[model samples]
Target: MLKTTLGQWRMFRAVVEHGGFSQAGDAIHKSQSTIHHAVQKLEDSLGIKLLQVKGRKVGLTQAGELMLRRANYLLDEAAKLEAVATGLGAGTETQLKIAVDEVFPQNLLYRVLDTVSAQFPLLRIELMETVLSGAQELLEKARVDIALSPVPLANGFNEEFCQIEFLAVASPQHALHQQTQALSYEDLKSHRQIVVRDSASNSGKDVGWLGADQRWTVSHVRTSIDMISQGFGYAWLPVPAIEQELQSGLLKPLPLTQGVKRTAQLYLCFADGDRLGPAARTFIGEVRYQSESLLTAEQLSDSN
Candidate 1:
């Protein structure tokens, strides 16, 4: 049998967090005496001194510090329990917000979305196409329910979703392809390089950008592909995104001694995994299914 109540632990934590009984009471809309009584009863039940006081100042004892840690974890679990109950009671969500990095394969994304839509016809979905850290920012800010990003956000959970292959290429007729020898950094830097701008507002980043004498920054991968195919500049573009250009000889691979091909692993991250409703869970499952199916199909094609 449990001798202590969660209510007592809640009050105990509130006192420590707010720095005093009166402050805790004010914060929790309880009287100071009530808060003090709860904490006192909690300590009595636990048979330990949880707090110390000196001249109107309150601080936790050594044992109180450990108890406070456990109290925090307990309270967090309780909150998550409530959130799970609430989500289950709410049934399917009315809307789903998702942020997807531009690098993720469009075919796979579209297929998954089509499947999810068929399952939940009335569920509204707001899909934001982002570049680089844009998806991470949206997920971190709780603006999106889920995000696909190359790098996982700090203090969040993520699962490996897929790997995107980026190939450095230029137009077949471009001057760089005229060289017989493998291209060096100096050789590539002399020509114009096209780069996709990171879509994050405040903390955008640049990747796969060589310090070329001339550079063009665009907002989307398609824009970069279009510019590069027109012989305006050279850039590393995702293989799935530039398949037609590759097959048609519009874009030829740059023969770099190193980094000719780069692979980035994308992760599927949830803003709040525990609070995801039925719709979000369904979407996540479909994403996994579609990604695996695509990979398997591609492998079979390669094998043949």
Candidate 2:
């Protein structure tokens, strides 16, 4: 028996990722037969089957799953080795990618970004503005180094960043507002509700009240806010994103008997929280600082 080569592992991982040999070949820019031969040679060297074909698609065998995990770790190590080598010479990353959920305060993030850019003038920044589970998905794919996600990050060091308050509101001119009586859950059920679609890759859910016979789904929270402000429907919107509307008397909180507002706790998460580059560390610190400031402001307001 011969030792398995890194090349085989690379091809195997590609096949599993792309879901088929032909797809993997297309991704790796190799002939399908060449890709198939490489994986076959790999199985022969290891004396085990790594994949099973199901119709036109391919699935990893139990052994393949374990091997794939190890391969990814090795690949990550290889990448880090290059990063370390480059850092010793360059002293900075060429680009820093960060993923953030819309649930998190955008203004605070902008402030943090401003600080990061001010300090690292030459370092390029990639901002991935995602919603719902999009941040988590980006993190899992190794697409971004840091993430501020609404959902719990499954594979990183995560800490509570801040809680955002959401107010259930509708246009002031909405029929629900015209009612002389307080709006109840039953009344809401009859009116249309604007709901933001969860951006999760799998098992994306519909959050909050859906009792309304009529529902409109939007990809982003701001879109939902726009729909609600237009008197098209009612929704639970983050208070910060609707502050102007609230102040201008365009959007008013639902006069619900209960559950007029809800708080969503967002987390600041990082895949390598401890080994973050200087740019990432600075950004995270600034983000945390701003988050604390927001919390303090909220507390003071509540006290008054």
Candidate 3:
């Protein structure tokens, strides 16, 4: 059995992420020479060349890739152990850290959290609202216990969550209301629009029949809704976020020929699958229950 140091494992993981010692050094805030020396030491100790230096670029060898995966698993287990130990001394309830997409309606999440608080008031819940990609990264890094993000994982994260529907909406006083009974994509494109800029890509998709103009690129869903409410531009918001606004006639659903519908799946990704603590498991269960209940209510209303 080869003895591996945590520092070597961290260096290996960093190199795999940044693709080079220089970049990895920048990320880890270390000198490039130091990072290279550490990696060299690791390779020497393991008796294998982990990375192949191809010109200026660095590529992982088969052994390197395998080692990286194992390294991540080992690190995750170590973190869970620390968390468990800390939790034992603190109390029976553990802290649950969750990362959520900025587009998720706070009201809905609060409803879910309220239920969890009532059930387990002693548990500490930490919520972070960030971009979808950032949230996914947090989950992979074990920076968060779980994440609430769009259905499809933008990165290589495995989807272990539920899905919700997205709706395109506008303020009731907007010009689209004139044709509310028969809204088309063309009508929406002709009006000033506020859209969630695809942070992952510069190109915008023609949602349904509505063409996105590059002039108004709102980064956050909450900002998009605020802009639409102020009549700055119309936007496609998640139904749950703007459900109350639509019901109260503050915002109106666009009448599209194809009915612009997109499903936003909420995934609860974790770094270590087997190491979920009691608080993390309880929080996940609450979210799942809330999502199922909400879906059921929506279906019942639609049926009625």
Per-model TM-score on C-alpha atoms: 0.73, 0.85, 0.70
Clashes of 3: 1
Expressed as tens digits, the lDDT of each residue in 1-304 for candidate 1 is 9989899999999998888999999999999999899999988888999999956878999999999999987987788798778778888788889999999999888988888889999999999999999999998777898999986988678899799999999999899999999997788888999999989989658887567999989999999999999999999899999998999999999999888899999999985687898788889999999899888988999999
lDDT for every model? 0.90, 0.86, 0.72
* Stretches > 4 Å off in candidate 3: 1-93, 102-105, 151-162, 179-181, 198-210
Give candidate 3's TM-score: 0.70
Model 3 lDDT per residue over 146-192, tens place: 77765344444455556657777777777777763777666666788
Worst 10 residues of 3 by lDDT: 200-209
* Residue-level lDDT for 142 in candidate 2: 76
lDDT for model 3:
0.72
In candidate 2, what are the lDDT values of residues 40-150, reduced to their tens digit? 998998899999988889998999889899998887777777766676577666678998888777788889999999999998999988887788888877788888888
The candidate that achieves the highest lDDT relative to the unseen native structure: 1
The runs of at least 3 residues in candidate 1 whose Cα sits more than 4 Å from the true structure, single-residue gaps closed, are 1-86
- Top model number, TM-score: 2
Report lDDT (Cα) of residue 219, candidate 3.
Answer: 75
- With a 3 Å backbone cut-off (N, CA, C), the pairs that clash in candidate 1 are none
